[model samples]
Target chain A: MKEATTSKIAWGWLALAAVFLVYPLVFQSAFFRDIGVLLLLAAISASAWNIVGGYAGQVSVGHGMFFGVGAYVPLMVFTHLGWPPLLGVPIAIVVVLVLSVIVGMPTFRLQGHYFSMATLAVAELIRLLVGTWDFAGAAIGLSGPAIPRGWWDLTFTSELPYYYIFLGVLATLLLVTWQVQRSRFGYYMRAVKAGERAAKSLGVPVRRTKLFALMLSAAFTSIAGSLYAIKTGFVDPESGFGILVSVQMLIIAALGGAGTLIGPLIGAIILIPLQTATNTWFGGGGSGLTYILYGGIIVLLARFEPGGLVELWNTYAPRRWRSGSHAP
Target chain B: MLLEAKNVAKHFGEFRAVADANLTVAEGDVIGLIGPNGAGKSTFFNCLAGDTEPTAGTILFDGQDVTNASTETHARLGIGRTFQVPATFEDMTILENVMVGAFMRHPGRADARAHAEKIIEMTGLREHAHLRARSLGTPGRKRLEIARVLATGPRLMLLDEALAGLTPGELQQAITLVRRIHETGVTLVIVEHIMEVIMTLTARVLVFNQGHVIASGKPQDVVKDPLVIEAYLGHGHGKRARKRGPAA
Candidate 1:
C-alpha cells in the first residue's frame, strides 16, 4: 500500500513538472507570464510557511523576517562585494536558517496567540532596524548591479526567464515539503500539533521538532526572498518586511488547506489570479477588494467547508486519482 | 527487575504530591497501585514514566539509572505508558495511531504497519482499526490507547487507569487482556480504582494514602491489612467489624 501511494505521488509530481515546463510555451502571453511568476513565488513562500504553520500548528505572523533577510542578504552581498547572485542565494538560506533558530529559541516558548504576537514584533523590529541602518540603505532600499542580460545573475530582461526561475524554485520547494511530510520529523511535528501532552507521553521530542520545522520553513522562505530580489532588482524595508507578506502567506495556506501537501500550491493558483484580477480592475482599491474577497472566502469556507478545498475535493473526487494518497 | 522506583518524590509548589514512593517489578509481573483520589497515584506514575521529573530519588529501568530522562527518551528506552483519559491522535485512524508507536521501534513503515496489525488483532481492534480513533466508544478507545502503547515494544508497561469507564463485561475482557499482555513477558504497573480488577489481575498490590505507601505485598494479604482497611475500605469495614464483634 505504501509503495502504491509513493508511486502515485511520483506520477502526480511528474505530471505537474511537465505542465510547469510547457505552460509558458503554450500560453505565450506577457500578462499570464507575470501572473505565473507571482503565483509560483507565492506558492513557494506559502509552502515554506506551511511547515511550521500548517504541520506544526504554530501560526507565524513574521515569516517576512526570513523572507526579507533572504532578499536583503543576497542583495547586500552582491552589491557590496560584486558576488554572483547564485552564490549569494545559498548564503541567504544559511543566514535565515541561523535566524530561524534565534527567533525560535525565544518565541517557540510562547504558544498560540503569544507566539504570533512575538513573530509580528520581531518582523516589525527588523523593519525598524533596517530603516535606521546605514548599509541596508535605511528606508530607501538597494538595487541590483548591472548584469549582461543573462540567467546567471537571475536578473532576466524578460518575464519568461523569471517565470521559469520562480517555477523551478516552486518545484524544488514542493519536493522538499513532500519529503518532509514523509520523514520522521514530519510525523513528530504532526504528533506535537495533535496534542503536546500526548506526543510527549509517546516520547516525541516536542521542542526539537518545532525548531526543525521553523528552520526548514525559514530556509525555504528565504530562498523565495532571494528570487524576489533578483526578479524585481530592488528591495526596501517596507516592501520586504511588511505585515502583508505574512498575512498573504497565511491566507494562501489557509485558503487552500493547511496541513495538506499540495494545499498551498492550489491556494496560490486560485488566490493569486483573483488578486491580480482585482488589482487590474479596481486599481488603487485593489488591496482592499482582495482582503474582502479573502475574508469572504474564509468565512464561507469556515462555515461551509471547514477543511477547505482539499477536503471538498477528497469528498467528491475519484479516490484512485487523488494526490497525497497517504491520508486515511 | 524490568523496572524499579526507589523513594521517588514529586512536589508541586509547596505541596508534596508523591512522597517517598517505591516499587519493584520483574518481567511478567502485574502490580496494581490503588489509592484515594488525592493520594498521588497519577503523580507517582508520571514521575516513573518521565512525564514529570521527580524532586528526588532514582528510577532504575532494566538496571540503569533513568531518573530524569524525557518521555520520548524513556519510550526509546523501552517504557510504554497509557494515560488515564485515553490520549490518542484523534485525527489519525486507530491503525495509524498504533503505527506511530510501532514506527518508534521499527523505522520501516511496512514493518511497523505489520506489527500494528498484529497488536490490533490482539486487542480486538481489527474491525475498528481503519476508523478514526476519536470515533471509538469509551471501552474501545481505552483498548486503542493500550494497543498504541503496546506497539512501542516496551519491556516495561505502565497503565494509568486502563480499565476505567468500562462495563462489567468490558472490565473482564480488559483483565484478560492484561493477563495476555503479561504472558508476553512485559512487566506491568497498573493504577486502577476497580478493586475487583486489582484482586484478579495483580499478583502484588501497593496501597497509597495521603501521598505515602501504606502497604505492599500479595494482593489478597495486603488488601486485608488493618491499616489499608482503615485508610481505604473506611467505616464500611468498621461496620462489618462491629457486626462481627471484633474477631468472630
Candidate 2:
C-alpha cells in the first residue's frame, strides 16, 4: 500500500515535469517562452536558497553577492578575453566557495536577526564594491560580447535554446536538492534549525554543518546567476547584487514552501506570471503594486501559515496522496 | 576513574558559579548531585558536560584530558547529558529524536533506526514513538531526553533536573528508568532536587552550597551534615528544615 502511494506521487511529479518540459513548445509564443525561462530560473535560485535559508534556518540576505559573482564573472570574462560564457560556471563555483567561507564563517556565528543583518551588510558591501570597480564596468554595467550563436559560447538567438538550457540547470539543481534532503546532512540541518544547542549536544558539528549548507547554497545560486546572465546577455550590479534580487528568491521559497522540494518551483510558477502581468498592465508604476501585493501575501503567510503554501497543501490534501514524506 | 575533575571552576565576570569543585566517578557508579537553588550545581554539571569551558581545571574521562572539548566532542567521547528543561527536538518525532543520538555510533540510517527503536522500547516511549516531541507531557519529554542520550552509547550520563516536573507516579516510573539505566553498567551523575528520588536512586551523594561542595557521602550522611542543613534552611533554621527533610 505504501509503495503504491509512493509510485503515485512519483507519477505526479513526472507529469508535472512533462508539462514543464513542453510548456514553451505548446504555447508557441515568445512571451510564454520568456515566462517559462524566468520561472525555471527563479525556481533554481529559490530552491538553492532554501538549502540554507529554509533547511538550516539561516536567513541570508547577502546571497546576491554569490549571484552577482556568478553573473559578473562570465560576462566579464566574455567581454575581456572573448571566452565562452559557460566557462564562468566552473570559476563561479570556486569564487562562491571562497566567498561563502568569508561571509559564512563570521556571520553564521551570530544568531537570528544578527546573522541576517550581517549578511545584509556583506551583500551591500559587495554591491558597492562592484558598482565602483572600473574593470567590472562600475555602475554602467557590462553586457555579453557579441559572439557567434553557438552552444560553445552559449549565445543563442532564439529564446527556445535558453529555455532548454535553464530547464536542464533547474533539473540538475532539483536533483541535488533531493539528494541533500535524503542525506545525513539534511537531518543535521533540521536538527540545527529546531535547536542549535540540542543538536550540538547530540554530536552535530553545528557551525561546520551550517557552513557546508551555505557553501552548497551559494554554489547553486551562483550557477543560477550565470544562467540568468547568459539569458539576459547583460549584467548590472543593480540587477545582479541588488537586495531585491536576494529578497525575491527568498519570497519565492517562503511563499511556495521553504523546506519542501517542490515549494520553490511552485512559488516561481505562481509568482513569475503575477509579476509579469503586473509589470505589463501597470507599466513602470505597476512594479510597486506587485511588490506591495507580494509583501502583503508574505505577511499573511507569516502570520497565519508560518510553513507557507506547502503546509497549506499538506493540511488540505488527502493524506494518502500527499506528495512526499515529511520525515528527514 | 571513569570520570575525574580537578579544581573545576566557572566564573561569569564578577560572579563565581562553580568554585574549585572536584569530583571522581568510577565505572558503574550512580552519583546524585543535590543542592539548593542558586547553589551552582547546574553550573558545575555544565562544566563537566563540556557545555561550557571551566575557568580553571582539567576534566579527565578515561584518563584523557577533555577540559575544553565542545559538547559534541564530549558526546563522541562517551558522555551524554540531559538538560534541565528537557531539550527534546520539538519538531522531530520521538523516534527521530532518539535516532539522532543513535546516529553517533551507527551512522547508517537503518542501524540508527533499529537502535533507536530498542531505546524507545526500553524507555517505554514505544506508544509515543511516532508523536512529535512538542506534543508530549513533561514526563514523556524527560524520558525522550534520557532515551535520546542513552542511544548515544554514553559511558557516563549527566542528567540535570530529570525528576523535577514529574508527578509522584511519574517520579516512581522515572526512578525505575534511572535504576534500569544504572543496571546497564553506565555511570550516572544526576542533578536533581527531589531528596526522596536521590536517596533511593543514588548510591553516593554530592552536596553543593554557594559554589562549594558542602558534603559528599552516602545520601543519609550527606543530608544530615550541618552545613548542608544550614544551606537548605538558614543558619538558625536548620532544625526546622531538617525536620521537613533533607530537601523539601
Candidate 3:
C-alpha cells in the first residue's frame, strides 16, 4: 500500500516536470514567457527561504542582504574588472557565504522575533550603505551589459533564454530540497523546529544544524538575485536590497505552505500573476488595490490556517490524493 | 562502576537545588531516587543527565570523566534520558519521533528508519507509528519519549517519572517495558514517586530532603530511615510511622 502511494507521488512529480519543460514552447508568446520568468524567479528565492524559515524555523526577515549582494557583486565586477556578469557568480556566492555566517552567528542565538529583527536591521543597513557607496554606483545603482556583449552577458531582447535559465536553476534547487527532505540533516532540521532543548537531548547539534541551513538558504537566494539582475538589466539599493523583496519571499513560501516542498512554486503560481496583472484585470488605480488583495489573503490565512494552503489541501484533498502517510 | 557522581551539586544563586549528592551504579544495575515534592529529586536527575551543569563536583560515565559536558555530549557518550513532561515532537509521527534519536547512531535514513521501527515495536507503539504524536494521550506520549531514548542505544538510561499519571493497566505495561529494557542490561536510574516501582524493580534507593541526600540503602531500609520517614510523614507522624514503610 505504501509502495503504491510512493509511486503515485513519483508519477505526479514526473508529470509536473514535463509541464515545466514544455510550458514556454506550448505558450509561444513573449508576454506568457515573461510571466514564466517571473514565476520561476519567485519560486527559486521563496523555496530558498523555506529552508531556514520553514524547516529550521529560523525566520530571517532580512534575506535581501544576500540577495542584494548577489545582485550587486555581479554588476560591480562587470564594470570594474570588465568580466562577464555571469562569471562573477562565484564571487557572489563567496561573499554571500561570509555574510551569512556573520549574520547567522549572533542573530541565531537571539531566536524567534529577535532573529528576524536582527536580519531586517542588517539588510536595511546594507541598503543604506550601498546607497552612499560610489563604488557600487551609489544611490543611482548599477546596470548590466547595455548591448549584447555576448551570450555570457545574458542580455537579450526576448525572455526565452531567461525563462529556460531560471527554469533550470529552479529545477536544480528543487532537486536539492528533495534530497534534504530525505536526509538525516532534514530530520535534524525539523527536530530543531519543534524544540531546541528536546532536540538537544536527542543528540542533535542544534546550532550547527541552524547554521548549515542558513548558509545553504542564503546561497540559493543569492543565485536568484543574480538571475534577477541579469533579467532586469538594472539593480539599485531599492531594487536589489528592498524590504519588499524579503517580505515577498516569506509570503510566497508561507501562504502556499511554508514547510512543505513545492509550496513556493504554488505560491508563485498564484501570487506573481496576481500581483503584476491586477491593474489590467481589475481596472484599478494601481498597486493600492493589489496590496489590499494581497494583505487580505495573508491576514485570512494567518488567522484561519497558519499552515497555509498546503494544510488546506491536506485537510480537504480526496482520500487517494492526500499524502497518505501524513494523514494521521 | 558504569556511572559515578562525586559530590555533584547544582546551585541557583543562593538556592541550592541539588547539593552534595553522590551515587554510583554498576554496569547492569537499576536504582531509584525518591523524595517528597520539592525535595530536589528532579533537580538531582537533571544534574546527572547533563541538562543542568553542576555548580561543583565530578561525573564519570563508563570510566571516562564527563563532568561539565552538555546534554548533547552526554547523549553522544551513551547516556540517554526522558523528560518529566513528554517532549515528543508534535509535528512528527511516532516512527519519525523515534527516528530523530535513531539518527544519532544511524546517519542514513534507511538505517535510522529500520532502527526506529524496531524501537517503536519494542515500546509497543507499532500500532501508532503512522499517527501524529499530538493525537496520543499522556501514557502513549510518555512511552514515545521512552522509545525515542531507547533508539539512541544508550548504555545508561535516566527515566524521569516515566510511570507517572498512568491507568493501572498502562502502569503494568510500562513496568513490563522497563523490565524488558533492564533485561537487555541497560543501566537505569529512575526518579519515581511511587514506592511500588522502587520496591519491586530497584535494588537500591536514595532519599533526598531539602536538596541533600539524607539516606541511601536497600529500598526497604531507606523507607524505614527516621530522616526519610520524617521527610515524608512529617515530624509528629514519623514517630508512629517508624514501624511501617511505604512497602515492607
The whole-model lDDT of each prediction reads 0.84, 0.88, 0.89
Model 3 pairs whose backbones collide: none
Best-first order by lDDT: 3, 2, 1
Superposed by TM-score, candidate 1 places the C-alpha of residue A226 at a distance from the truth, in angstroms, of: 0.9
For B156-231, candidate 3 gives per-residue lDDT tens digits of 9999999999988899899999999999879999999988888888999989999999999899888777788899
DockQ score of each predicted structure, in the order shown = 0.43, 0.44, 0.71
> Which is the winner by lDDT between candidate 1 and candidate 2?
2
Per-candidate TM-score against the hidden true structure: 0.91, 0.94, 0.96
DockQ of 3: 0.71
lDDT of 3 at A221: 95
Query: What's the lDDT of the predicted structure labeled candidate 3?
Result: 0.89
lDDT of 1 by residue, A7-42 (tens): 987787689788878888887888888888898999
The Cα error of candidate 2 at residue B133, in Å, is 2.4
* Candidate 2 per-residue lDDT over residues A1-328, each given as its tens digit: 5478778968978999899888988998899898898898999999999999988889887789889999999988888887887887889889999999988898777777777887789889999999999999999888985766566877777889988888888889888888876666887888888888888888988999999999999999999999998878899999999988998889999998888788998889999999899888999877688669678878988798877888787667777655443332
Which candidate, 1 or 2, would have the higher TM-score against the true structure? Answer: 2
> Pairs clashing in candidate 2?
none
